[model samples]
Target: MASTRAWILKSRPTGMPDMGNFELREREQEALGEGRVRVENRWLSVDPYMRGRMNDVKSYVPPFEVGKPLEGGAVGKVIESRSPHFKEGDTVFHMYGWRDQAVGPAEKFNKVPPLGVSDEQWLGNLGLTGATAYFGLLRVAAAKEGDTVFVSAAAGAVGSAVVQIAKAKGMTVIGSAGGEEKCAWVREIGADAAIDYKAGPVVKGLMEAAPKGIDVYFDNVGGEHLDAAFATARNNARFAICGMIDAYNGAPQSFRYMARVIAARIQLKGFIYTDYLPEMGDFYRDMGGWVASGQVKSRETIHEGLEATPQAFLDLFTGGNTGKMLVRL
Candidate 1:
C-alpha cells in the first residue's frame, strides 16, 4: 500500500472561497486492482467553473461532496498499470485533479497525443479551455468574417482563445482585461483593441473600440460587462454566454439595460463544451493547426506543488493569472 495526498472539500463557501473551505489530507491506496492504472499527477487545473461545483446546488454538473476529494482536469504519467490500455510512463489526461496521484480503471484516463504542446496544455488550450472558446464563438455566437467581436476577461484562458479564434476568422476583436499589462498582452495576441476594464467603464471602452457597434459578444464576465455588451451590441448581434466569472462568487449586481437585448434583437445563448463534443475533432484539428502555425498562442500562469492548489484557485477571483492557471504537482 502507498499513501496519496488529496484536497477534500471541508465546507461549502460563502461569498468567496478561502483555505478554510478545503482540507489537504493523506490517504492510503490499495494495490492496483484489475483493469486499473495508477497515475502520478503532474499538473492540476484551477478553473472558474469549479467554483460553481463547490456549492450544493443543482446545475449542469453535480456539486462537490463535502468529504470527498475535489476534482477537475489533470494531466499525469502512468507509474503502473494492470490494464492493457495503458502502460508505464504513458502520459494521459483525466478528470481526477486536486491530488498528487489518481488510481482507477484505465478507461478513466485518455492517452495524450504526442503533440509538441506541453502536458499542462492538455488542461488548457488544445483541451477544454480551447474547445470552449471554439464552440462558444464559432457555433453559439456565430461569429463571421469582418464582424466585430467583444470578449470580456479577455486575458483568461477561454477569453484569450476567443480573441485568437475571432482573428483567425477575420473578425475584428476588442478584448477587455483587468489591467494595463494584461490588456497589452491581449493586443499582442491580435486583438484590434484591448480595453482595460479597470481603467474606466466597460461600456464606454466598448463604445470607443467599436463606435459602430459590435456584431458578436462573448460573455465571460457577467455583471457590468454583460450589460455593456448588451448596450453596445449591433442589431441582431449574437451573444455566447460562457462562464460568468463575475457572478460565480454569488455577488449581487443590478442591471438597468437589459431592454437593450430586446431593442437590438440580440441572440443570447449559453453553452457548455460538452454540448459540442461531436465537433471536438474539428476543434482540435483547427486549433492545433493554428498553434503550430503561430496564428494562435496559449499562455499559462503556473503555481508550484499540490499544496498551492487552494491559493491558485483563490487567485482566479483576484485576476492573479493572465491566462490559464495551473498547479504543477
Candidate 2:
C-alpha cells in the first residue's frame, strides 16, 4: 500500500491560527474502489476563507472537524483511475486539498481543460479566486462602465482580479493595499489610484483619491475598509461584501459609518463564490477572453513542499503574500 502525508486539524483555533493547531501525519492509502480516482496533488490553494472553517461554528459551510484532514481546492494529476470518466495522466481540479495524495469518487474530480495556460493558473486566475471577483463585481455589486470603483486588498488574488476586470470594462478603479510596493503593483495593473492603507487612515486616502465619492465597492478586508467605503460612497452605491479577512481571526469589527448605509442608499450584498456555480461557464468564457487578451494577469506566492502549507496559510493574515497564496507539493 502507498503512503500519503496529510495535514490534520489538531485543534480549533482561538484567534489567529498557528502551527500548533495542525499535525502532519503519514497514512496508508486505501484501495481504489470502482468508479474512484486517486490523484497526486501538484498545487494546493490556501485562501482566507479557510480560516473560518477552523472554528466550530455554523456558517455557510461546515466547520473542519478535529483529527480529520483539512480540505480546500487542489489541482492534481490522475495517478490511478478506476472510473470511465477519467484516464491516467489527466490533470484535474478537486476539493481534496491539504493532502499530497487524494482518493475519492471520480465525480468529485473535474478534468481541467487545455486552455494554453499553466497548471497553477487553474488554481489562481482561472479558479475560485477569479470567479469570486467576476461574480462579486459584475453580478453582486452590479458595477458598470464609467463607475468609480473601490476595492480593498487590491494586491490579493480576488482583489487584483477585480481591479483588472473593472478597468477592462471602462470603470475607474481605486485599490487599497498594505504597502507601497503592493500599491505600486495595483496601479501598474490598471488601477487609477492605489492607496497604501498602512501609511495612514483609509478614509483619508480614499477621500483624496476620489473626492467625488465612489459608485461601487468590492470589500475583501472588512472593518475599517468597509467603514471607509461607507463614508465615501455616493448615493445608490453598490457594495459587494466578499471576504472579511480582517476580522476572520475572531477579531471584533466595529464600523462607525454604518449609518451611511441608509443615508447613501448603498446596496450591499454578501456572497459566496459557490452561489453562482450555475453561471461558471459564463465566468470561464469572459475571464478566458480577458486573460488571452492580456487584460487580466495572475500573481502567486508559492510555498514549496506540503510541509510548508501551514505557514503559507498563516502568511495570509500577515500580508506576506502579494497575490494568491498556494502550496506546491
Candidate 3:
C-alpha cells in the first residue's frame, strides 16, 4: 500500500496556535471503495477560518479532532475514480486539505472548472476567498457606485478583492493595512486612500482619509478597526462583517463605538460565505469578468512544501502574507 503524509491536530491551542499543536504523520492508503476516488493533492490553502476549527468548542463548523487530519481547502487531480462523475486526471477541489493525498467518496469533491487561471487560483481569487470578497462587499454591504467604502486588512485575500471591486464600481475606497509597504500595495491596487493603521490610531487614520464619512465598511479585522469604522460611518452606513481576525486567537476586544450603530442607523451584517452559495454563479460571472478585463488582480504569498503549513497558518495573525497564503504539497 502507498502512504501519504498528513498534518494532524495533536492538541488544541489556548491562545495562538503553535507547531506543537500539529503532528505530521504518514498514513497508508487503503483500497478505494465503491463510488470513491483517490486524489493527489497539489496545493493546500491555509486560511484564518481554520483557526476557529482548531478549538473544541461548538461553532459554525465542526472542530478538528485531535489525532485526525486537519482540513480546509485543496486542489488535486483524481488519480483513481470508481464513480461515474469523475475520471482519472480530472482536477477537483475539496475540503480534504492538509494532506499530500486523500481518498474519499466521489461526492466529497467538486470538479474544478477550467477558468483561465492556474489551479492555485481556484483555491484563491477564483474560489472561496474571491467569492467571499465578492458576496461580502457587494451583497452583504450593498456597496454601490460613488460610495465611500472602508476595508480592514486591505492587503489580504478577501480585502484586496473588495478594494478592487469597489474601485471598479467607481467607489471611493479607503484601505487599512499594517505597514507602509502593505499600504502602498493597497493604493497600487486602486484604493483611493491607504491608511497605515500601525502608524497611528485607526480612527485617526480613517478620519484623515475620509473626513466627511464612509458609506460602507468591509470588516476583516474587528476590535479597533470596527470601532474606527463606527466613528467615521455616515448615517445609514452598511457594514459587512466578513471576519474579525483580531479576536480569532481568543484575544480580548472592546467595542467602544458599538453604540454608534444604533445612533447612526448602521446595518451590520455578519455573514459566512457559504450563506451565499446559491449566488455563486453571479460571483463567478462578475468577478471572473473583472479579473479577465484586468479590473481585478490576484496576489499570493506562497510557502513551499507541506512542512510550512503550520507556520503559514500562524502567519495570518502576524500579517505575514500579502494575499492568499498557500502551501504547495
Candidate 4:
C-alpha cells in the first residue's frame, strides 16, 4: 500500500502566498474503485489563475476550500488503473493539484502521448497554457497577419508561445517583460521589440515601441498595464483578458475598468478553457503540427520535487519563472 503526500491549504492568502498557508500531511492511499485510476503526479503546473482560486471569492472557477489539497492542473503517470481503457504507466493530465498522488475516474483526466519534445511541453506549449494562447489570441482577439500585437508578461510560459505563434501568423509582435534579459529573450523568440515593464511608464515605452498603436492586446498583467493598453489601442482593437498576474500580488485596483473598452472601442473577453474545449481540438492539432514543424518555440521552468510545490505555486504570482512553471517529481 502506498501513502499519499498532500499539501492542504491552511489559510487563505492576503497577497502573495507563503508556506504558512499550506501544510503537508500524509495519509494512507485508498483502493481505486470501479473506473478509477491512481496517478503518481510527475509534473504540476503553477499558474497565476491559482491566486484567484485561493481566495474565498467568486469568479470563473470555484475557490479552493480550506483544509483540502488545493487543486490545479497536473500531469502524472497512472500507476494503477481499474478502468479498462487506461493502463498502468500511462501519463494523463488532470486537475489533481498540489499532491503526490491522486485517484479519480478516467474521464476526469486526459491522456498525453508518452514521449515528446519534453514532458514539460505537454503542460506548456502543447497543454493548457498553449491552448489558452492559441484560442485567446486567434479566436477571442481575432488577430490577423500585419496586426501589431502587444502581450504583457511576454517572457513567461504563455508569453513565449504567443510571440512565436503571432509571428508565425505574420503579425508584428512586441512584448512587455520585467528585465533586460527577458526582453532580449523575447526578441530571440521573434518579438520585434520587447518592452521592460519595470523600467518606467509602460505606456510611454509601448508608445515608443509600437508608435502606430496596437491591434490586439493579450493582457496577462492587468491593472496599470490594462489602462495603458486602453490608452494606445488602435480603433477596433481586441483585448484578450487572460489571467491578471499583476492583480494577484497586490492591493486590488478597480480603476479604468469601463474606459478600457468603451473609450477605445475595444472588444474585451475573458474565457475559461473548459468552456472552449471543443475549440481546443483545432488548437492542439495546429500547435502540435507547429511543434513538429519547428514553427513554435516553448519553454518550461520545472521545480524538482513534491516538497518544492509550495514555492513553485508561489512563484507564478511573483513572476519568478520564465515560461510555464511546473514541478517535476
Candidate 5:
C-alpha cells in the first residue's frame, strides 16, 4: 500500500478559485474492488464550468467535499485492470479528478480510442468541450444553416468548438474574445467576425460586426457579455446559455438578462452537458470525421506534471490559454 500525490479541495470557493482552496497532499491508494480498474492519468482538463462545482449550491454535478479529491474529467491509461471490459495498456476517459492516479468501476469510464486525436483531445475537442459545443449550439440553439452565430469566450474550450461546428453547418460565426491575440485566433479558426471584447463596449462591437442583428448567441461568459448579446440579438433568435465565467463569482441574483428574452421573443435555453449524453454519438461522429479530414482544427495548451493542474486551471479564468487547456500528468 503506497501513497499517491493528489490535489484535494480544502474548502469551497465563493468566487474565483484561489490556490489556497486546494492542497497538494499524499494519500494511500485504495484497493481496487470487483470490476474496477486502476489508471494513471495522462492528461487532465480544466474548463470554465468547473467554477460552478466549487460552490455549495446545486448544479448539474455535485459540489466537491472538503478534504476530498477535486472533481475533473481526465484521460488516463489502464495500469491495472480487474475487469473484462478493459486491460492493462488500454486508454480511458473518466470524471476522475486532479490526481496522478485513480481507480473507478469499469462502467464508470469510456474507452478512449487511439483515433486521430491525442490525449489533449480526449479532454478537449472530442471530450466534453466538443460535446458541449456540438449539442449546445446546434441542438439547443437550433442553429440553422446561414444563421449568424455569436459566441462569447470565443477562444475558449467550448466556444472554439462552436465557431468551427457552426461554420461546418454553413452558418456564419462572429466571436468575442478577451484580447487582441485571442480575437486573432478566433478569426483564424473560422469566425467571420472576431471582436475583442476587451477593446471597448462589447455591445457596440457586436452590433458593428452583425449590423442586421444576430440569429444565434452561444453564451459562455455571461454578465456584461450576455447583456450585450441580448441587446444585439435578432427577433426570435436562439440563445444557448452555456458557462457564465464572468458571473460565476458575483453576488447571487446579480446578473439578469430575462427582460431581453421576453422583449425580443428570443428562445433562450440553458444547458448542462451531462443532460445531453444521448447526443454524444452525434457529436463524436461529426467531430471525428472533421478531425480526420482536416476540415476542422483544435488547439491545446498543455502544462506538464500532476503538480501543474492547479495552476493550469487558473489560466482558464484569466484568458491565458488560447484553446483547450490541459495538464500532462
Candidate 6:
C-alpha cells in the first residue's frame, strides 16, 4: 500500500499563521471503494482566501479542523479509479490540496477540460481566480467599456485577470501593486496605469492615476485600498468587494471615506465565484478567447514540492508572489 504526506492544521491561528501551526504526517492510502478515484496532485493552489479558513471562526466556508488535512484547490492526474466517471491518467481538478495524493468520491472531482493551455493554467487562469475576476467585474460591478476601473492587488491571480479582462472589454484600468516591478508587470498585462502602493499612500497614488475619479473598483486588498476607492469614486461608481486580504490576518481597517458611498451613490456588492456557477460556460468562452489572443496572460510563482506549501501560503500576506502562488509536487 502507498502512503502520502499531508499537511494538517496542528493548531488554529490567532492572528497571522506560522509554521508552528501546521504539521506534516504520512497516511497510508485506503482501499479504493466503488465510485471512488485516486489522484496524484500536480499543482496545489495557495490563495488569500485560505487564510480565513485557518481561524476557528464561522464564515462563508467552514473553518479548518484542528487535526485534519488542510483543503483547497488542486489539479492532479488520476492514478486509479473504481468509478465509471473517470479513468486512469485522466487530469482532474478537485478541492483536496495540502497533500500529494487524494482519494475521494467521483462526484468530488471534475475532469479538466482540454483548453489548449498548460495543465497548471487550470489553477491560475481557468480556475477559481479567473472565475472570481470574471464574475466580480462583469456581473457584480457591471463594468462596461469606457469605464475607468481601479483594481487593487493588480499583480495577483484574480486582480491580474480583472485588469486584463477589463481592458479586453475596452475599459480603462488602473491597478495597484506593492512594488515597482509588480506595478510594471500590471501595466505590461494591459492596465492603463499602475500604482506602486509601497511608494506612498494608496489614496495619493490612486488620485494621481485617475484624477477624474474611477467608475468601477474591483477590490482585492481592502483597508486603505477600499478607502481610496471610496475617496476617488465618480458619481454612481460600482465596487465589487472581493477578498480583503489586508484584514485577513486580523489587521484593523478604517474607512474614512465610506460616507462617499451615499454621497456618490456608489454601489458595493460582495460576491463569491461559486455564486455564478450557471454562468461558467460564458466565462470559459470569453476568457478562453482572450487568452488565445494574447490578451489575458497567466503568471505564477511556484514553490517546489509539498514541503514548501505552508511557506507558499504564508508568502501571500507578505506580497512574495507576483501572480498566482502554487506548490508543484
**Per-residue lDDT of model 3, residues 1-329, tens digit only:** 77889999999998898889999999888799999999999999999999889888899889999999999899999999999999999999999999999799999999987667679888888888999998998899999999999999999999998999999888999999999999999999999999998899999999999999999999999999999999999999999999999898888887988899988999999999999999989888888788778889988999899898999999999999998999887
Candidate 5 — worst ten consecutive residues by lDDT sum?
249-258
What value does the lDDT take at residue 195 in candidate 3?
Answer: 92
- Top candidate by lDDT: 2
Off by over 4 Å in 2: none
Off by over 4 Å in 4: 254-260
Per-residue lDDT tens digits of candidate 5, residues 1-329? 88888889888886778899889999888898889999998888887777777888886778778888887899888998999999898888998869989888999878986575776787777888988898898889999899999999889888999999999999999999988898999999899999897889887898899999999999988777788778887899999998788777773432355678778898888998777887778778889998878777898888999888888998887888988898887
Relative to the true structure, how large is the alpha-carbon lDDT of every model?
Answer: 0.93, 0.95, 0.92, 0.85, 0.85, 0.94
Comparison by lDDT, 1 against 3, better one: 1
Between candidates 1 and 6, the one scoring higher on lDDT is 6
Worst 10 residues of 4 by lDDT: 251-260
Query: Comparing 2 and 3 by TM-score, which wins?
Result: 2
Per-residue CA lDDT of candidate 6, range 210-299, in tens?
999999999998999999999999999999999899898889998999999998999999999999999999999998888888889988
In the order shown, the candidates' Cα RMSDs to the true structure are: 0.9, 0.7, 0.9, 1.7, 1.6, 0.7
Give Cα distance to truth, residue 135, candidate 3, Å.
0.7
Over 1-329, each residue of candidate 1 has an lDDT whose tens digit, in order, gives 77899999999998899999999999998588899999999999999999999999999999999999999999999999999999999999999999999998888899997778778878888888999999999999989999999999999999999999999999999999999999999999999999998999998988999999999999999999988888898899999999788888888664767888888899999999999998888998998889888898989999999999999999999999999999998
Residue-level lDDT tens digits of model 4 in 1-329: 86889889899988788999999989899888999999998888888888888899898879999998888888888899999889988888888878989888889978886446666678888888888898889888999999999999999988888889999999999899988988898999999999988889888888898888999999888877787788789889999988787677675755564575676688889876666888777887789889988888877788999899989888776668888888988
What TM-score does each of the candidates earn?
A: 0.98, 0.99, 0.98, 0.95, 0.96, 0.99
Error of 6 at 127 (Å): 0.3
Clashing residue pair totals per candidate (backbone < 3 A): 0, 0, 0, 2, 0, 0
lDDT of model 2 at position 254: 70
